[model samples]
Target: MNLTAESVAEALVVNVDEERIDAAVAIQFKDRMRDLTAGAGGRIILDLGRVIFVDSSGLGAIVSVMKFLAPAHRLELAGLTPNVGRVFHLTRMDSVFPIHADVAAALHGAGHDL
Candidate 1:
């Protein structure tokens, strides 16, 4: 799980730098999310452009990360490939999180600092 966290406007953009977010990396993903999200305020945009596949475990990990944010913050997903998009749709997670076509779109006008 190669995760990079950067501040973009009102969001903390965390890009998943690997090709897959399956069972093998699910734990790593969750743990890294915890470390990266420390004291992070406002919106979180998870850039999944490089991620091509996600198993059930991966989905659960993502959902858990969202839950950890809770009412004070929000988690948005961006740069979903076709297969990843389909999985989100099939799992009805598309309704749960705001999905953007790409990182640029996700950060558009979301102005903030730190």
Candidate 2:
């Protein structure tokens, strides 16, 4: 798994390079995200453009990250591939979190608060 973090506009853009976000990679993904958001004091935009697949464990990891952020930090998802989008739709997680079609949209929706 590979993750890269960069400051984009007012949000932190986390680009995931993993092919799958499943049980095998959940822990690492969660830990990396935690570190990326640490003291950043801004909304996080997880760019899932490179993530081709996601499973229950992956979704759980993402949910855990959001929970960790709580009412303080904000986390949003963007550029979900079709397969991952299907997962989110199947799990109804699309309603639970904000999903954007691209990084620009996600950052804009975050309102430059980051």
* TM-score to native of every candidate shown: 0.92, 0.91
Each model's C-alpha lDDT? 0.86, 0.84
- lDDT against true structure, model 1: 0.86
lDDT of 1 at 5: 98
Q: Count steric clashes of candidate 2.
A: 0
Model 1 lowest lDDT segment of ten: 105-114
Clashing pairs in 2: none
Model 1 lDDT per residue over 1-114, tens place: 789999987789998999999899899999999999889987899999899999889999999999998877788888889998888889998888888888898777442211
Compute the lDDT for candidate 2: 0.84
Residue 10's lDDT within candidate 1 is: 74
